[model samples]
Every structure is written in structure tokens, then in C-alpha cells.
Target chain A: MAKRLQRASETVFAPEDPEFQIAPMVDVLLVILLFFVSITSAETIKARPQSLRVLELPVAKDSKKKETSAGEVVINAGWEDGSGMLEVAEVSTSKFADPDRMRQFLRDAVKADPSLRALIRADRKVEYGFINQIMLVCTQEGISNITFAVVDKERQG
Target chain B: MAGGGGGGGEEGDYGFQIAPMVDIMFVLILFFMTAAMMKVSENELGIKAAGTPTASQEAQPAEIQLRIDADGTVSFNDRVIGSPIDDSLAALRSRLKEAIDLFGEKQPVVIIPQSTVKHERVIEVLNACAAANVKNLTFGGGS
Candidate 1:
């Protein structure tokens, strides 16, 4: 048994004919693929609520581009399909018709982080009056940092 | 994982299967390609919202008043700057650009749009302002 093992080691020189490691290579590819699949699923889940609103934002050719921040407060303004009423949302998927509720949410958000930015994602079809009300809430809350999300005309369809 | 690579190899016989590897690679490539197209980048235009009434008021400065009519007509300081529905607000952009070029970027602009006007119209006006480089912009015609 000892002589047989020594002869096997001598014949199986690692550098001479290294195995192509097909299994581990496949394992690495699978890991990468799984990572990407997870990322895509999470993104889809996160975007579902926002995409349900069907906001066709106006294309702005010269709107200053700013990156979305984690610390900022987002206010989505859109029209409800069934009732044609104004809908507002904070971070949750739930949409509400009450501006007062949005006001309260903004107030608390401001209280939590005074420097938090309020990003408005209003549908282009919605009347300016509704958006004005949101601006008023921001003003009342003393949270002056505001941003409007628009589709960039430079990258338009 | 083992089933995908599960075919046990015989003694000294490699069990590498190009078929499954090729299948997963194709699926991953297709998913990635589609994912790349799924993202829509949103650009932001920033402005300072009105301060709380209790906050100290800014000192009175020269303010330019802009009004958007229900018909999408925009007037700058009561002067007709052409309707966006007709001219893409080209005239407005030029006038604002000329003013910014002359006075400075600090020139404040306040837009007062009719309550019934579509927000698209307002954004069009805002887009023109951005093109013309209006630095200080306020909505609702307030100080």
C-alpha cells in the first residue's frame, strides 16, 4: 500500500497535467449568476410600487442632475386612476389622497433630519395646483431643500 | 448545485459538461442584457422651498414675475414671452438668457401659474429657465 501511494504521487505531478477544474469554475459562475439574480429581483420588488403610479414625467433639457440620496425624503405626486384624485406617497407603497397626511409626514421627516431634502416626483399630467400644495407643506415644515425629478430630454425616447 | 454539476466522474475520467455551463451562461447574459435596459435614470432640478413664515424673511431684492396662463402662455414681468404651446418658449429662453447675461445669475424669478394649468406646462417654463440659467427661482410668485 505505501509503495502504491508513492508511485501514484510521482506520476501525478500537479504542474504536468493540471485538471481543468470544471466543477469549481462552474461553482464560481453560479455564484455570480445568483448574485445578479438576487439584485434584479430586489430591484424589481422595490420598483413595483413606484412603477404602478405610471408617471410620465416631463422631459427637461436643462434640469440640473442630482444623484438620489438615501437621507432625503421623497414625495410622489400622482393621480389615482379609479377616482382621479391626487395621490401622495412617502417611502411606503401605499398612496394617500390627503395632503394633510403628507404634511404630517414631511413635518416628522424634517424633525428627524432638518437637512433632509424633499424630492418631488409629480406626474406631468397632474395639475400644478396639487404640486403647489406639496411645496406649501415643505415651506410650512421649514424644509427648504427641494428637488424635482424629471426625465432628461438629453436621454429621451 | 451538484445535479447541475452532478454527473460523477469515473476514475480519472473528467465529468466536465459544456452543455449546462453554456445554458446558464446564456440565461445570465440574457437576464443582464434585459436588466440593463430596465433602468430609467431620473435627473433632478433643485430649488429652495419657501421658508416657514416664522423664519426671517430675505431682504427685498429685484424679483422677476413670471405667469403661466391656462393656455400655456408665459409672460415675463407682464411682457409676452411667447406661448410654450406655439414656440417651445424659445423667446422666453432668449429673453431670460439676455437678462442673465446682462444683470447676473442672482436675478430672482418667481413663477405664478394658474391653478388649472398642467404641471407639464410649468416644467416647460422651468426647463426654459434652466436653459437660460436663472439662478434664483421661486414658485407661486411669493418672496
Candidate 2:
């Protein structure tokens, strides 16, 4: 019956060519590229500055192990000699080191996501003056949820 | 041409091998994934930092004020307690717990840290507030 069905077709078709499938390979490559591009960008946005990367975080007995959620903007700060520097999402400006850029970023972020929260990671030796600047910026942008990163007091080493 | 620069005569039959390119891309992706995962996770303590509200003429509730000085001294309601030398602010914690018991967790608590105060000292005060389960927490000026 299969031979009769094949014989019934009057159309003549081209012969099947055996070769490497480049189209599927290209699709796989594109998918892989997209995956890494997205992942690396997210990690880069969450990256901290050098000061916050190595500084000793303050110890707290009540710090909770909350799973980090989306819509969080990390602000890294450091202060010395009556001056301070601010880095939002690992970006620091060459000009006078002001929070104007950070303020604008926060405003836009809050507009995009009303649930945006600020996660401040500052050095232990940094002065409150700097941290307050970050808090003021957050409040001004209508982001009332402020989180501070700290080490567990029991793990003081 | 001796250096095989644009000679176009060696293995020209194979236009481009996707196999080797794919291998290299996979390795690069693995490297970046590991680097991103290496970032250490940190514990977080949060506060709802809102703007100061305008004063009302109606009868108002009592507010608890905690002040931190530049020299690491912490004052609760104008009375100094807890030595900054100790890591654990046990005294301040107990007093804050007592205040919560009386005024309830909804009572407003303001933390005022001086300009030059170290962040570590300020966090100590916040630690005490967290232990006492203070719900209405805010940051205020160093008045």
C-alpha cells in the first residue's frame, strides 16, 4: 500500500541533500548569546564599588536573611576627611562626586517601579552624613523602603 | 603570504566551522556564570524612611527620640546609656523593649545621628530598635 501511494504522486521532487545544518546551529548560538548577555548585565548592575566590596560591614543582632527581591537599587558609599563619595549601581561620576545623578536615577527607577527599594552598603568607618544623603535621596524619590547590609553580630570575626 | 596572512589557500573548503565557535562561546558563558554566583550574600536590616510630616495642632502622641553623637555616645530621651566600647548595646535594647511594652510598637521612634558619627555606631542603635520590634522607625536631624 505504501508503494502504491508513492506511485500515485505525479509530482517530481528534488533529491534530499545530506549536509551540516547551519540554520539550527545559528539559532542555538543566538539563544546562548541572549542568555549570557542578560545574565551578565544583571550582575553588572548589582556589582558594588571597591570600597564596599572589601569594607567591614557593621554588625547587627537583628539583621534578617531576607531573599533579595527585584526592584532593588544598591547604593555604595564611603566617607573620609569631611568628604564623601556616592556610587549607585556601581557608577561614579568624574565630576565633584555628587548625588545629583543618583537622585535622577532613583527618580526614574521609582517611576518605573513604585516598589523600588534602596539597599545601602557603606563602610563601618563612614560617617552618618553620607548615609543620610542616600536616605534623603530615597525619600525624596518616594522610595520609603530602605535596607542596610550588616554582618551577624554572632559571627563577629 | 608566507605568514599565511590572507593567503586564502589553506583549508578554504571549510567556510566556517560552527562547532569550534560554539565550544568557545560555551566556555565564556560558564566563566561569567561562575563569577556572578561568587558574590557573597549579605544579611539586611530595613527601615521605612519617610519624610517628616507637618505638625498638627491637635493633641499628638508621644515620640521617642534616640540621638547618636560623633564620639559614639547614644542618648535615649536626653539620658545617656550604653557604652559604645561594647559591641552589644544591651542596656539600650532593654530600655527600648520596655518603651515598646508601654507605648506599643506603633509608637514613633526617631534616630538622630550626628554628622561625624561613624556608621557602625549608628547601626548599633538601629540594632537595638530592631530587637525591640519598633514598627514606626524614622531618621531625623541631629536636633
Candidate 3:
């Protein structure tokens, strides 16, 4: 009886048990989690909010063009489909509207950050007058660094 | 005897659980996949502000004037180039290059686009100027 009982206890608590080991699996999951976390954070700089519709940017043949740096103020210029009006950063303005207010806004922004640059994301179908007006505002506000956002022609393929 | 054996089998069945852990990992993977799909790449073309003095008049050998009508017609130095499209852009580029050779590379090319012209057409003109190695560009006919 004593020998039989000893064999039964050893079988129940054996050294090589079939129990699941979590350490190795946990380590792998942690590595994958870190990789995804890094990717998501790195992408936030270029991602705009979903509420803003993307403009069909003009294509530039220069594939090696530089991208706008972070922290620069980006102003979106697109035609509002509903109202059929030109919208600059969500403000509806006429083709011949006064640019004083826009200039003042840029002036204040530049004053707060001297190294600030202005990036205009205008739609391809937009008229030149709208873009010129925004450029004029940027100049009058004393903001010299200005760039137009464009899509890479070669990369579209 | 059968009851005692059944009790012993039940005790041995308790081990580490892995189903919950795998569920959590799958959830995390789904979240990241969605986030990565939302990101978009952006590119930019640098243009000098109008009011800034990009080049001195003495350094500029000559000036080339470019005009774009409301109908996407492109003209250089008052002479209209070919139709304002990809095929005709080559002609515009050559004309711009000729001006660059006569006026020196530092010549400023001023672009005057009518308010009704499409912005894409203006960009095409700008691209042509860039291809001709013209560095100094200015926008005229104020908004």
C-alpha cells in the first residue's frame, strides 16, 4: 500500500508536467506590443484628424522634394462642397475678401513662435486666386518661410 | 473506488490558463492594425514669400515674365508657349532655358496667373521653371 501510494503522488506532481508555460509566450507578446506601439506613435506626426477632408494635392515631378517639418502651422485651403465657397482653415471667405484677419492670425502665431513656418495645403482644383491670397497673407504677416503641400507624382504609382 | 479516482483526475486537470492571454494579444494586434492604416504621408514644395527679397536686382541679369490665362494657356516673355499641358510643357521648358542662358542663371522669372486659372496649371508652370534650372521665382499681379 505504501509503495502504491508513493507512485500515485509522484505521477500527480511530476517534474516534467504538461502544464502550460506562460513566460516564453508572454515575452513574445511583449515584444510585438512594443513594436506596434512605436509604429503608432511615429505615425501621429503626419496624420490629420479624420473630420478634415483631404485635399487632392497637386503633383510635383520632383520626387526628392523635402517635407514640411513638424511644428509648422498648416492651413488647409479647399472648396466647401456644401456651400460652394472657398474655405481657409474652416473660415469661409469670398474670392475678394479682405485678408487683414488672416494676416493678423498668422502674425500672432508667428509672434508666439518665431521659427514658425506656414504650409498651405490647397486642393489641385482650387483657383490660383485663393492660394495667392493666402500667400499674400503670409507675406504681410512677416512670415517668410512658406511652402506648398504637394503629392509626389512618381510615388502615386 | 471509482469516485476516489474521479476526484484525483479532477485535481490534476487544473493548470495555467492561456486562452485569456491570447485574447488580449489579438485585441492589441487589431488596434495597431487599424491605427497604421489611418496614417498618410505628406510632401511639400518650397515657395518664397512675395514680400521677401530673395535676390538683389544687381545680381539678377534679366527678368522673364510668365503668364497663365484662365483657360490654362501659358505664355513666356509675352509670347505664348505650346498648349498648357504635359506635352507642351517641354516647349515651355526650352523657352525658359533659352532665357536662362541669355539672362544668366540668376534671372528672376515672374509668374502672373489670372484669378480664374486652376492652381494645378500654375504648379505645372512652376515645375517647368524648376526643370529649366531657374531658381529665382516671383509671383506678380497681386491677389
Using TM-score as the measure, which candidate wins?
A: 1
Clashing pairs in 1: none
Worst 10 residues of 2 chain A by lDDT: A88-97
Q: Which stretches of candidate 3 lie over 4 Å from their true place?
A: A1-44, A47-52, A81-100, A154-157, B1-41, B54-59, B101-105
Candidates 2 and 3: which is better by TM-score? 2
Model 3, range B58-89, lDDT digits (tens) per residue?
A: 65566777888888887887788847555339
Query: Order of candidates by lDDT, top first?
Result: 2, 1, 3
**C-alpha lDDT of candidate 3 relative to the true structure:** 0.68
Question: Number of clashes in every candidate structure?
Answer: 0, 0, 0
Worst 10 residues of 1 chain A by lDDT: A43-52
- For residue A35, model 2's alpha carbon misses the true position, in angstroms, by 28
| A32 Cα displacement, candidate 3 (Å) | 17
Question: What DockQ do you compute for every candidate structure?
Answer: 0.37, 0.32, 0.32
TM-scores, all models, native as reference: 0.66, 0.65, 0.63
Instruction: Write the residue-wise lDDT of candidate 2 on B16-120 in tens digits.
Output: 545556667677667767654554446778888857454555543588888887788888888988666856788888988988898786677889989888899
Tens digits of per-residue lDDT for model 3, A33-116: 788878787732543423445567777675235543665766766655522123344233333234455666677777888777
Model 1 alpha-carbon drift over 4 Å, by segment: A1-52, A81-93, A154-157, B1-39, B51-61, B141-143
> Which lDDT tens digits does candidate 2 get at residues A38-127?
766653234457543355678886878757657788777766556776666535533234666677778778899999888887778888
Better of 1 and 2 by TM-score: 1
Sort the candidates on DockQ, descending order. 1, 2, 3
